[model samples]
Target chain A: MRLSKLIAFAAALLLWSGAARAQQVSVIKFPELQKRLSRQNDTTYVVNFWATWCAPCVKELPAFDQLSTTYAGKKVKVLLVSMDYASQLDKKVKPFVLRRELKSEVVLLNETDPNTYLEKVDPKWSGALPFTMIWNGKKSKRATFEREFTPAELTAEIKKFLL
Target chain B: MKKLLSFFPALLALVLLSNFVDGPAGYQVGDKVTDFKLKNVDGKTVSLADNKAAKGYIVVFTCNTCPYAKAYESRIIELHQKYAPQGYPVVAINPNDPAVAPGDSFADMKARAASKKYPFPYLQDETQQVARTYGATRTPHLYVVTRRGSDFVVSYIGAIDDNSEDAKQVKTRYVEQAMTDILAGKPAATSSTKAIGCTIKWKKA
Candidate 1:
């Protein structure tokens, strides 16, 4: 039992050291997000809608995390917007971020009515989790995907918007 | 030519229609839906045709595993109890592929239905054909359809209420409102709504 305890302690230490700065999650409303999306800028924003409990959404985070590093210096910004209830921000969203050691900007969508936001954001979206939107506010050029992304697929999208 | 100019309106309509064609092409409001047979948790095949007396159906695509579905489970039961007697029955369908989401398997569905003593039919879309035809994208998605001759016309497609997380805090009951409108021999004032939910687990190719 003592040996197992020591190993567990070491494992916890390793996991703790692996995590970078804890992500500061900003809970924002749909109007605020719309304001951000409608900005006039050259920076390409890769925003992903995901939740803590969604299995496929969790599976695709590594891809988004990889892009955060691969384009760390560029004008590209990867934002992970948690579709998990805003009430779960401190309990689920923040802990999941720290545990996964996410290196991208994370935010919680603080809205109760999805009907108001879903259509405003993208008419094509069926309010499915793991939705992604790659856009540049400068040209009003945007591409929305309502599906999970593999690392390779994510990179290809990045090529279209970033490269 | 003047003939080409005359066809401009027709051509423009096609162009506008194509622009609105997004990924999923499911039933739209007022679209006639064919009856479908699916296996219920009671080891019986159930279909819309079975419920001849029902004026409308609140077809819900939900799963046992989804937290969103679980959150609204009790409210779903209440909906059936309230509206079923009013000739609108809740027909819950589990659309998640069992292989992808094990908790949504047939056995688990049966267990859940039995435990809850659901007052409605909890059917399984094992082939997922019905779900694909109806364009169900996520768990706890709803469609309220009213009988029109031999077919059912979609009256509403979307969320059950304004609040998904808290049933008590719900302000607008979309499905109930649709049922009320249909019963009143009028079209639903709020035809469609949307809510964030777990994506249906489709079988991988």
Candidate 2:
């Protein structure tokens, strides 16, 4: 009886963890992202745009994860905004995030038209993956990088805004 | 000291002027594109001028590695088959640097072309000069160039279709629409768009 009870507990634990993992991804519009950015008080947001298909983007994800963990206690928030197709949310994006056990907050940018939304994200973006934008709420200062970042580079960039 | 001060302003003006002369890099709609001699997969040199029968060129910057490129591969083949006889032949150029992206190397391109049985020429931009000139930022980037008198002018620039993931769900055929407009002697309604695909892998500086 005790063994059966323990087995049920283990199954429940597995199911609960699975639910938590699935809840990690949030489908966000550009406006919601803007609002979240504006609401931050003294936090420096390191928002990275990436996709599973983009080789460089995938290669550089570990750096973002390292930054998130290293600066957990700090005012820096690393939000990984996925640019994968909406149709790939379940089939690709979610599975990738869960498999990698990515610690950073992952969200899918749920916009259809890249033409209008690309400009809204950043006029200079040119619709490239692994794009990062660092902004400090207090200073109202922001910087954008269009290329992949190494862990040291990511940390240094975040430090600039934090300092 | 006076001469030096005056020289600084002239130097600054020259610097600004030089940057201006460089002039918003990349081809825009209506800009004339120079013919380039690039090596094709079939081990022969090909150029825009080589296709004398073509009225326009469907110049596409695509690589072997990109998932977006892979998804659009069959559609790209279909586009070539459908349009090649009608004047606009597809000229696919692998723009990614082989060193940076080994999967986009000449051998890989050749193998991919052979396996897919591409009817059109799949060329390699070894220096990526052609892609730089065209300002192709992503894989599967499309540019429709129409012959204008003695020059080839850019008529449309963007994606093949609205949906990159699934072909059946594609609502707007951007490339097809552009070609139709150009063939009918009308201006393309959507001349330029944000190209959504894998960023072209450039060699590290």
Candidate 3:
């Protein structure tokens, strides 16, 4: 009985460690972000650039959560790309993502320079956060809201792009 | 003659529209920066051309208001203190129109300078022409220029570091790293960074 209990405890430890490691958010490198943008088959990718410090971003996050749920099992993929500092991965980002129960895949951008990556993401981008981009199979359409956006406003944009 | 006249107008419009499409106002890396004489917190006139004798100048467009700008104030101060004597004096300019952002007015700017005990020139761009020339669209926007012979070439552009709140949490120090490489006459590995900040309040058309 003692041996069996020890084995069970060891298995539990292994499972816990595996879960913890998986919970670690990977900072998306520029090339990887590009690949992710391009490699999608039939799914539409909706990427929203946001930061934890941004009040508007925080406010609009729930709407994105709802959108992700609404599009469940569909070809639509919602990607919440946090432009927050990479150090916030464990300290703030992951916790926020977990607390909000974010359904979409979350990525904190790893690349440093925006001038190089901004144009790569979309030529029309002015490096504005709270920026939303929708990539259909053919072309990627982007909209930058200089101010905060509402759920309805975001949905309207998605509708326009998805069509 | 009619066809030529019509084609000329179309060509002219296309050229003008193309200029608008491309960012013509913003200063690019390695472009010469034109110096401007502006009033400082101490009510003294400071000009980049006058300080052209230095190896380079760190020109930052920051304001009294804006949380992101406030977060960077200490880092800016540290930057000025660390590299001012080393031929890279920081020249801070307030780019926001007072009518739009009252906190960025000269009076508030003076108060901010006094409260922060800023060591660099916290100048006021009253006409905001200098801000337009540099395409300064936000507070805490930075442009680092180096004197390449007689010309002032921009060495770096973007945020001071990755994190605005905690310096320790910064994954990338764009300005610091750029200045270090620039001081050594080497190319900056990364030249720019982008972050959302309060927009510069421009005068209404």
Candidate 4:
């Protein structure tokens, strides 16, 4: 009886630790993000810029999550870049991510002062939440959408890069 | 081959439709603004021409539903209190279609203004033409239109300041600086900026 109780507690600890580890969010600067986009690799990247406070951004996250799941084996990467202030990482961002159990990789964009960095992210972007961009370094082509995407619309956009 | 051919027409139609949706880039920094008469929350029509004694206007596109707009509400009020005497009164407008964003309905706007005790004219852009004409992309977007002879030319376009989340941590006051520059008989140093905010919920086509 004593052994079984100890083993159950150990298993619970492992599960708790694993779940906690999965909820950790990386905070990165714009240069670091730019570095990933500038890579000469063949992988296609679907990057979505969103925020927890943005109602539309939150509403559209599930579509991105679904895309990430369906394209798991493909040479595609789905990145959800959180525009929530770095100060809210512990308070809001992490809690929201954990609650959603988001399958896509999520990170906090640490850069502030949108005037200086907005154009750098993408000239087409007008600094709005729920923006999406798909790029392939090998293809040397990218498409930007400064609006929310439906699941079907997102899949169609990603399908072009897959071809 | 047949499947790929089917996609081309859809793609072409999308391109053409987007052109219609985007319309035009209404006002640039130096372009003179045409006056607009929008209904204020008090059930009275207000126009830029009505402010006869003012030198210019600080026009802000804001909505009650957006967090960014809510965060800047107090600062917006403070700006009107300070700048109205300086001959630059703030005119706040809600461009969101209430059907799309129920919280931005005229009744909700009236409640918000009354509860906040806003000292400025809070107007409703029922058709959203004013917002589109001004090329406003997000909530809390601002345009600094100063008097140039008899015309009101846009002097600055963009964010109210560098920081949108916290006003206390702000380093540069973009709108305040613009007002000071125009007041001192010079053009603004930084006439434009960019800040992230909720996308304007346009009425469905």
lDDT of 1 by residue, A62-126 (tens): 89877867987777887788888888888999989989988887878888889888998898889
DockQ of each: 0.63, 0.45, 0.15, 0.64
Best candidate (score: DockQ) = 4
In candidate 3, which residue pairs get closer than 3 Å at backbone N, Cα or C atoms, i.e. clash? Answer: none
Q: TM-score winner between 1 and 3, please give it.
A: 1
How many clashes would you count in candidate 4? 0
Tell me the interface RMSD of model 3, in angstroms: 3.9
Error of 3 at A99 (Å): 13
Predicted chain A of candidate 1: TM-score: 0.82
Residue-level lDDT of model 4, residues A1-163, one tens digit each, is 9999999999999988756655788999988988766665688888899999988889889999788579878878888999999999999999999999897778899976888788888876777788888888888878888888877888899999988
lDDT (10s digit) by residue, model 2, range B4-25: 9989998999999975644335
Of models 2 and 3, which has the larger TM-score? 2
lDDT of 3 by residue, A24-119 (tens): 566988888888877545666777777776555788888876876676666677777887768678889999887876766678887555655776
Which of candidates 2 and 3 reaches a greater lDDT?
A: 2
Superposition error at A107 for model 1 (Å): 1.0
> Predictions ranked by lDDT, top down?
4, 1, 2, 3
The candidate, 1 or 3, that scores higher on DockQ is 1
lDDT of 1 by residue, B79-170 (tens): 88998998889999999899999999999999999999998999999999999889889988999889887779899999888898887788
- Name model 2 segments beyond 4 Å from true: A1-23, A37-41, B1-24
